[model samples]
Target: GARHGINMNGKLQRLQEQEERIFSSSCENLVEQIIEKKKKKKRKTIETDE
Candidate 1:
């Protein structure tokens, strides 16, 4: 029974780790997207002024 419990706990830990990795990657992608949007807007404004 102890071994079974340990196995279950390990499985839960792996799932939690995977979820954290996924969440961080999603956050990074969102940040990159926002940065890209700002850059594009700045480029558009510069071109219009020229």
Candidate 2:
């Protein structure tokens, strides 16, 4: 029983790590998208000014 408990804990830990990695990668993608959008907006404003 103790061994089983240990195994379960390890599995849970691994799953948590995986989730954290996915969450961080998705956050980075969101940041990149926002930056791209800002750049596009700046270009539009510059073009209009000219």
Candidate 3:
């Protein structure tokens, strides 16, 4: 019973790590998009002020 429990724990840990990696990569793309949107907004405001 202890051996089976350890095996399940390892599998769960690996799955968690994989999910984290996927989330982090997707998060980077989201951050980049947000930055781009902010830059665009700033440019528009500058143009309007001019």
Top-TM-score candidate index: 1
Tens digits of per-residue lDDT, candidate 3, 1-50, equal: 99999999999999999999999999999999999999999999999999
Candidate 2 lDDT, 1-50, residue by residue in tens: 99999999999999999999999999999999999999999999999999
User: In model 2, where do residues sit more than 4 Å from their true spots?
Assistant: none
**Candidate 3 CA-lDDT value:** 1.00
Of the candidates numbered 2 and 3, which has the greater TM-score value? 2
Compared with the true structure, model 1 gives a TM-score of: 0.98
Per-residue lDDT of 13-50 in model 1, one digit per residue for the tens? 99999999999999999999999999999999999999
lDDT of 1: 1.00
Cα deviation in Å at residue 44, candidate 3? 4.8
TM-score of candidate 2 against the unseen true structure: 0.93
What's the lDDT for candidate 2? Answer: 1.00
Worst 10 residues of 2 by lDDT: 1-10
Residue pairs clashing in model 1 are none
Per-candidate Cα RMSD to the true structure, in Å, reads 0.3, 0.6, 1.9
Candidate 3: segments with Cα more than 4 A from true spot = 42-50
